[model samples]
Each structure stands twice: as C-alpha cells, then as structure tokens.
Target chain A: MAGSSVSWSERAVRLLRRMNSFYSAGSSRCQCWHFSVGGMEVGLVPPAVLKQLRRFPEVFSFKEEKRLELNPGLASYHDRSSAVDRVLQRLREEERFTCLQGWRDEKYEVMPQFSDPPLMCMERAATSLFGVKRYGVHVNGFTRQPDGQLAMWVARRSLSKQTYPGLLDNMVAGGIGSQKGIRDTLIKECAEEASIPECIAAAARPVGTVSYTYEDGEGVFAECQFVFDLEVSSDFSPSVGDGEVHQFYLWPIEKVKDALVTEEFKQNCALVVLDFLIRHSYLHPDTEPNYLELVVGLHRPL
Target chain B: MAGSSVSWSERAVRLLRRMNSFYSAGSSRCQCWHFSVGGMEVGLVPPAVLKQLRRFPEVFSFKEEKRLELNPGLASYHDRSSAVDRVLQRLREEERFTCLQGWRDEKYEVMPQFSDPPLMCMERAATSLFGVKRYGVHVNGFTRQPDGQLAMWVARRSLSKQTYPGLLDNMVAGGIGSQKGIRDTLIKECAEEASIPECIAAAARPVGTVSYTYEDGEGVFAECQFVFDLEVSSDFSPSVGDGEVHQFYLWPIEKVKDALVTEEFKQNCALVVLDFLIRHSYLHPDTEPNYLELVVGLHRPL
Candidate 1:
C-alpha cells in the first residue's frame, strides 16, 4: 500500500488493486452475503450465488456480518456422497451457468483439521461467491545439459481450452481436485500433460507456494499454488498425453526470461517461472531491482 | 488481520505479530522514522537510532512519511571507506549498546545494476536501530543413504560464540558479509564452518529465501535468508573448520523434525530445516495438516 519512488500511475494502481483485492474493500457499503466457517466470516460472496443457495435452506443460514453459514448439521451429506455436489451440479446444468468448470470433484479447503478431516469440501466452490481456499500444483520442468546450461519445457494450451485458450503454460499445471491431494494431482498432471512417468514425477520437489486472493468475473479467487520443480534427465523427451495442451517447447532459460517480460506466458505461470529463476540463482537480490518487492508481491497477504 | 477458527492466544498472537509485523498496521499513531525505497516505506525505525545516525549527517536524511533516507550519495562510499564505518565502529565500541553484532562488511542489497555494483554494503546495518534488510545464507546439509532414508548434519554453535551460543544450527549458515557476494559468502561459510571444499561447495544449489521482520531487545530486525541445499556425499564427514561450531551431529530427518517442535534448534534453523523437509518430500502436504500454512508462513511476506 506504500508507494515509493516507483510512482505507479492511477490506472496501474487501479488494475493492481483489482487483481489483488481480497474482500471487496469497503465491503460494509456493498450488499454482499458473508461466507463463514465455524461462525467466522471469511468472505462476502456475490448475492446472486446466495439466491441460488436458497433452495438448500437446511444447509445454509444467515446471521451476523450479513453472514451465510454452512450448517454443521449438513456434514452428514458430505459432497463425496453426492449430496450437496449433486445440488450444485443441478444448478450448473439447469441454470446453465458458464462458470462451472465441469463436474470435477473440486475440493475447496475450509478450516484446519488436526486429526480428523475437514467437515466437507466446498464442491463447485470456485465459481461461487464464497472465499473458500483452492489449491493447485505447478511444476517447472527443466533439464541440465552437459555444458551446465538449463532448458525448460513449456506448454502451450490448446485454443479449444476453456481458460486462457492458446496461452503458454508451465510444463505441467493442474488443480488439487478433491479426487487427489496436492502431490497426487501434480503427479497426475505430469503424466497427463507431459507423459512424465510415475517414478520421475514423484521426484518433483515441493519448493513453496504463491498465494493471492483476487476477484475475477466469476467470483472471489483465494488461490494458493503449491509449486514444484522436476529435473528430468537430459535424454528424456515429453509428448502431450492430454488434449488440454496443444504442444510443448523446450526453451533455454534465457528465452524463458525474455518471454516472462513479454506477455507470452500465462499469467500465473510467469510467477512460477520467476520463483524458479530465483531458486536456480538465475535471479538474485543484487541482480533484480525489485527483488524484495517481487518476492513478497508474488505471495501477498489476503 | 482477519482471525478465523485458527485463533491463537494473545501471547502467541503478540509473538507472531511481533515477528511478522513488517508493514505498519495503521501504526501511524507511533512516532517512528520511516525507511523507504523508491517511494515506498519499507519499515519504521526507532528515533533513538535516528539520533545515533545524526552523527553521520551525510549518510541519512529525513523527508516524507516521517521518512529517513539512506543518501544515494553515500552509496559512493560503499561503507568500505573507513570514514562512515569508523564512526559507527566508534559508537559501537564506546556506547555499550547491547545491539551491536560486531563489525562486518554486511551487504546492504540495493537495486540491481549490472553496469556497476551496489552503492554500499549494510556493513553492520542489521544491529542498527533502523530496520534495514539483512541477508544471509542458510544451507540445509543432508545425506541420502543407500536405502534412501535421509539424515541431516546439524551444527552446534560453540558456546563462546556471540549469538545463539550452544544452540543447534544448519550444517552451515552465515551472513552475506560485505567482503563477498551471496554465493561467495556461502562457499566461504561452507569452508569455514564445515571444512567443505570449494568443489563441493559449488555443488550447493541456490534455493529460495525466507523473510521476517521481528522486534526484539536489539531494536528491529528485518531479516531475509537466501536458503541453499547441499546434498553432501555419504562418505564425506563434516568437521568444524572454525571455532564457530562446538560439534556436528548427523541425525535422522525424523529426529530433526521432532527437535524442530522443541527448543533444541535455534528459532531460525528450524524454519530452514522445515523448508528442506518440504522440498525433500519428507514433510508432505497430504500428511502434514499445517503443510500449506507451514510452507507459506515460512516464506512470509516482507
């Protein structure tokens, strides 16, 4: 929030504020419905989504903070049982909302559970007004040459894809769907996106994450990407196993950096690449002007 | 700032807030000097330090946001010039201030400039009353057995050392001193702390960083450790190259994890090891409940 000699323009500030805003700033003025967990408001989802939830009267209730509560009593109908997910699926299909990313078992992380599992995953939560946490895994695939040069395998999304059609992507990237955990989803994506074998896929290191809560056209996006790095043998070559990606290109690290400056890479993939460059020593505090700001800004506070 | 079901006690909250309070939390009420870069206020330092800083009026000045600017003109001195360092040295020698961590050429990292080097190194800016970014290299030293079980080499600081005496530490850790760049400093520390040869030290991969701003009796500390991971050969044994370490112990990663929960490891070393654990897949997201949090919290914003 503190501006310095940087001197960002009003337009740039507004764009940044739009991309980084978590709850609608000055939410008190907005007629929004709060999304709560264990009686605390985490977010204020769009009111239209609340209107749709009216059908499930027994599952949700309104209270303080203009809050909408997911009743603990509904735990009996875990989404795994197709109870609540079934209702959301019906709404997606019947109402024909464009936001539904299909009937995948997407689990929206709610509260922390020590010994036991979370009460339930928020199925179809991303497109909802709720500020439920969604997890994803992004893998940086690279190979080191005998001469010590590093080359990364980058993916180009198919034009037919729903989001960011034909955009450039990391070697492998996918959501941590309810069907699989973070690592599992990563391994699955590695296989599906780049045909990386299971043994090699498991070698991917969980480096860290880049989290941000921004509002898009759909709703609030409180996304946290658990990043990983996979160093494939120089002899290995990747072939797309899934139709999601159009093709793969192995570019020198320098080329990747150039693309990063341009708008050639997908939005989030650029951040992942920046993280990779930092860890690999390609980028250093002394070598990067906005070193501290870039590092902290990639993982901003919600 | 929003607390949910994840509520900590007032004491725990204070401890966390103190350690992570990099940004001014509407702390405009407090009378303090702002440390800015570009046009941004990175931190607010105590006035007592400002009073001390007044001795070298050429180095720092006050402006906006109650701002104290590290004069760009002083960058020409590089703190290598005895003129500025001598004054600070004298103050440290005569004042009997508990915060001085002794004289060293600390790298005060500034903007990137390939054409010319940074203006000046921190040159012992850490223990100063003003909060400036302090950089260090923390290496997670470990060996992989034939059976694939991982064990880490832990260093016990020599009881006579200046700080955290007798406390457990990473296999190698040291400040990015003014004399050398980050990589050179790490290589030097590896040699000085663990007799690791230049060839082996070069193999250490530059990982990411972990940042935190904490307030202690020593004024305010805004620290960022450029982390590294070195997979030492199984045959190699580490011996104390200097008197900084009392002894070295090679313990199972699990044992290290157990000790992490206790006070056996120094506050910061535990975090470095945790970062290693996550990277090595020893502490996985699926098994560890605070897995996501631990990863994100380790690399805090600013």
Candidate 2:
C-alpha cells in the first residue's frame, strides 16, 4: 500500500505523540500533581481531579507540595481499597465524575509497577480518573494465504459497547481485571469476543507490549497492552460470540497498512497493528523515517 | 538451559537497568549539563568532558549555565564539523581523553533525532565523550530446526577487537556511518562479518530496535541498535569472514535464554537476543513478571 503525500510513518508518529501527550514536555497535563499512595508514585492527578480530591481530606492529601497522596494511615491493601472505594461511590452518587457512568463493576490493581504488590484496587471506569496504570491483552489475529501473503483479522466494535463504540479493534482485547491473570484474560477474551476455540486461542504468542499515557477531559489514561500474535488456518474464521465486536473482516496486510494512518482503528489498537507491521518487516527503516520513534513511542514507560 | 536461582526476567531487567543506568534516578550523569548543538539538545556533557571543553572557547560555550552549546557562530554544517574536528584532533594529540586511544576514523551525525538533518559530524570514538546518539544495525541470526525448535547463531568477538574483545556478539553487527544508509550498512555488515550472500542477507527482516543510555567513568553512552531478524535456512551456516569474530556458535533457543543472564554476551548484543526471545514468544507475559519493563527498557528514548 502506498502512503499519502505525507508518509505513513509521519502520520503514525503524530498519532503516537497524541497518545503520549501527557508525557511530552510543556503539555498542560505535565504540570499535573503526582498521585502517590504509600509514598509511591502510581498515577497523575490532573488539576480538576486534585480539586475534587481536596473534598476528601481524610482520604486524599495534597500537603506534599504538587503531590496527592492517599492517607498513609490506611495501612493494609484492603483498608486502602475500601477507603478509595468509598470516595468513588460518593462521587458516583453525586454524579461528580462523568467517567463513573460506564462503570463495569470490574476492579484494577493500583501498584507502583505491574509486578509489584497491589496497593489498592479501583473500579475499571475510574482508572482514568486517577491516571493509574491499566493493563490489557490485545491479540493480533492473522492467517497466511495460499499466495504466501499475510492478512490480518480486524474487528469492528459493536455500536453498543460502552467505550470506543463502532471503532476498529484487534481480534480480541480485554482489560486484565484484578482477579484475572494476563493469560487467562487473553484466552477468555479470544473465545468470548472472536468465537475462537480454546485450543487455537491457547497457541497465541505473547509478543511484548505497547504502552502510553495521555490526558483528556475525563482524566489521565496510562495504559499498557500485552500484545499477542495468533496465526490461524486459512479456512478458519472468527465470528462474533458475545456481540462486543460487531463484525470481523479478514483484510490483506496492504489494506491494513493503508488504514493505519487514517486513525480508523481504536488508538491503542492502531499501535498494536503498527507493531505487527514493523515486526513482520512491512514498515522497514529503509522506507520509514520515523521507524525508531515509532518503536520508542509504542513502549513508553507506564 | 534452565535459569539460575534468579528468574531470567529479573536478571534481564537488572542487566537492562545496568545498561541504562544513566537515566535511572540519582545517577551522577543525570546531573550532567545538556550538550546542545545549533540550538538543539543533541547530547549530554559530563563534568569531566565539560572541564576539557573549556580549553576550546572558540568552538564550545558553557557560559549558558548547566548547558554546553557549540558556538552558535559556527552556522553551516561544514563550519560546525570542522570546528569540532579541530578540537577533537587537539584532544587526540594531547592525549586528553583515554577513549580516543581506540579512535575510529568513522564519523557520526549529531542530530536531535535520527531523521533530522545533522548539525555536524563527530568522530565515532568521541560520541560517548559528548553523549551523542549513536546507531547501528544488529542482526539476530536464527533458524527453525527440523523438530520445530529454534536456535540462534552467536558470535564470539576476536580478542584483538578494540571494544568488547573476546565477548559474545550477535552473528552480525556494524555501526551505521554518517555517510551510509541503514539497509546498505546492514547488508554490508552481514556479508563482511558473517560471509552471508547478498541474496540471503536481503531477506533479513527489520524487526525493530533496542536503545539505551548509560553513563560510565569514561563518559555518557547513548546508543540505539536497529534490530533485524534473519531466519536463514537450516542448511545455511554463517562463517567468519572478518577477523572481528573469532568463532560462531549455533545454540538452542533454551541455551540462548540461559546465557542472557550470565552477561556473557556483549551488553547490547544480549539485549538484541533478549528482544528476539520476546518477539518470538520465548519470554512470555504468562511467566515473565518483568515483561512490560523489559519491553520499555529495550526501546528507551535515545
């Protein structure tokens, strides 16, 4: 697929910069106060969140200069989880935050790092409000044609989905809830979203991750998606199972590359596809001037 | 083939952190002054380099407070290159920097980013002294065995080599000179170092990159390696063409993973192989707790 007058690499980098805007120097969110718990910086609190947080003086603190700290007195993980949950429930009832309207009743772990012990857990919808790190697994489904060319399976999100409705997504994607592990979530999502059998889904390979942080009206979103690539037989097709995905289309890799710069795919999902293109040697250094930048952008520290 | 007491993921992260020690919090080099060229921050100048730069007032200016800027008066690329070259030549003759002992006639472009127009060119050996970004091509030579298992071809550097002598290296690697392009250099290096034919080398897939910045006693080292994965036919074996490599070993994937923690490979080459493992699903999120961190560390901003 031929790129536009402006190379696809340039457009891809622009999209990545937008996704990582919060971390860019001189961005307004870069001025946001640090959100810390147990003296560990876990998230970023925007100005609006900071103001609202001031209302819960016993639960949140801004006493340490430009930092918002959870009450260190909430010693155990359960105590901290309950303390924050109480505040979120009050905010939901008061309709103080719009993000709470899409609450999935799911919880995400809050920790300094992914491998670290959880400091607390927060509602899935409320994660962006606190700018806590969110983790998910995204599967890149593809198959090899008889002509020896590769094609990717792209999913159009159901119009009824709560977030990013009707947008293009990977074949299977789901957040890793506090109660679930990465692999379990991945395999479960594959079967539920794409109707792929557990045996085939189990063969999906974990191929590193893509991470970025950006801030919007809702709050700040810092996320990392564990990426996987699954190659299925030519005759295999993924049909919608749970209706989260409206439709699945198997398109040539060339067509997928053309769509990448259009921003047609969900932002993070576009990154997953971009990583696939690079790994598969489609977006090469010889032709893509922004190759290195794209690589770094996809793997930013969460 | 088993990891030692420590998990391979932890050891890999520890090694990556060591390679990227300069960017970690509280590192001495983090306190170094920014080295700017043509109004762009292209490098980092440590205190030792700063002290020596004071000898050439006409070319370098550090009066800006915690920033080292090449004389703005040297406007054109040739002018800047010549001025910097004069000073470097002086340093070489006066034996001011021990790193110059391994001087390479090759020159590296000084730029804010790889695709940008270079402000000037500096001797490759002096890049570390100024902490400029240096890029090279590293090929992960691997092949699929008849049993469906994978193995990697690892090279042992000649003892006479100037840098990292007698250490393990990738099958093929070479720095990208200012005048040569990425693909040409990669193809050339593959042929020169491993005696790979042009047709075979042309099939190498440009997977991605591994970048890091570290500061040692000599100076700040910031570098990025353009990574390529070349899956040679099982019948094809790479032979040493250049004396830079003393021998080559084709090790099982499991053995390669085991050696990753020993630090037996050249620091950067180990990273290239580790990246290979992740890309091919050998190091997985299901088992590697540091999966995301390893992904981020391998692609740090240079």
Q: How good is model 1 by TM-score?
A: 0.73
Query: Lowest lDDT 10-mer window, candidate 1 chain A?
Result: A7-16
How good is the docking of model 1, as DockQ? Answer: 0.29
Which CAPRI category fits model 1? acceptable
lDDT of 1 by residue, A80-142 (tens): 234456657777777545577454455654543222344456664443456565668999999
Task: State the lDDT of candidate 2 residue by residue for B258-298, as single tens digits.
Answer: 88778577888999999999999997787788888899999
The segments of candidate 2 whose C-alpha lies over 4 angstroms from its true place after superposition are A1-5, A28-30, B1-5
User: Clashing residue pairs in candidate 1, if any?
Assistant: A3-B39, A4-B38, A4-B39, A4-B40, A5-B38, A5-B39, B105-B178, B108-B122
**lDDT (Cα, tens digit) per residue for candidate 2, span A258-283:** 78678568998999999999899987
DockQ versus reference, model 2: 0.86
Off by over 4 Å in 1: A1-34, A44-128, A142-150, A187-205, A231-238, A284-286, A298-302, B1-33, B36-42, B46-97, B100-128, B143-151, B178-180, B195-200, B234-239
What would you estimate as the lDDT of candidate 2?
0.90
Best by DockQ: 2
Clashing pairs in 2: none
Each candidate's TM vs. the true structure?
0.73, 0.96
